[model samples]
Target: MIGFLNIIVIICIIVFALSMLGMVYRVIKGPTLHDRVITLDAFGVTLMGMMSLVSIVLDTTYLLSVIMLIGMIGFIGTVGFAKFLEKGVIIENDRDNNS
Candidate 1:
């Protein structure tokens, strides 16, 4: 049964990789900036899933931290990109003083 489970995990990993490839293509050829940004976010999620599958196959806990790190980074990047798209800038400086 363990071997069967391993096979299933490997298959899932392969599927995730294929989906990531599709996401990458979308990111490169998407029709709009919003589409590309959404694709990039999906790609990051798929990557994390793939990494977790790898960790399961390897039977190690070392990758758990890496997975969390990836999630945080992906979230931040997506938010930043969205903010940039919405406001035309990621960081705004306030230089006006009326007091």
Candidate 2:
């Protein structure tokens, strides 16, 4: 049964890798910035999943924290990109408004 589980995990990892490759292609060839940003977000998610799978194969939990860190960074990056796309800047200068 352990062998069966290992095989399944390996298969899943392979599938995730293939999907990540597709996402990379989309990020490079996407028609617009929005498409690229979305693809990047998806790529981050795929990366997290792949890391989790690796942790499973290694029989360790250390990678879980790294996965969460990746998720947080990915979320922040996506939000920053979205804000930039909407407002033309990620961080606005409040000094200009006060003047």
Candidate 3:
């Protein structure tokens, strides 16, 4: 039943929202930077899922593209943040003596 499926989707989206609320708390009062980073990653993933669920609810596929783009950006950001947190740098310096 299409109606039943829609209900299931709606429930999933609601759950996603509730999870993000907890993540937001972690983001605001986390004791460490790593905890904040984890919360951010969770929040981003939840947003991407919410975008997909919205597209489904609206019977349109346009939001799918946006979802993918946002997901990729989130992944890249997480990687860069982790690298910086670990080593204090993202890109390595080119050591050359020529000036």
Model 3: weakest 10-residue lDDT segment is 90-99
lDDT score, residue 5, model 2? 85
Which runs of model 1 end up more than 4 angstroms from their true locations? Answer: 95-99
User: Candidate 2's residue-wise lDDT over 36-97, tens digit each?
Assistant: 99999999999999999999999999999999999999999999999999999999878768
Residues 9-78 of candidate 3: C-alpha lDDT, one tens digit per residue: 9999999989989999999999999989878988999999888898898899889889999999999999
For candidate 2, give the lDDT of residue 70: 100
Which regions of candidate 2 fall more than 4 Å away from where they truly are? 95-99
Between 1 and 3, whose TM-score is larger? 1
> Candidate 3: which pairs clash?
none
TM-score of each: 0.91, 0.92, 0.87
Report the alpha-carbon TM-score of model 3 versus the true structure. Answer: 0.87
lDDT of 3: 0.90
Which ranking of candidates, highest TM-score first? 2, 1, 3
User: Which candidate comes out best when scored by lDDT?
Assistant: 2
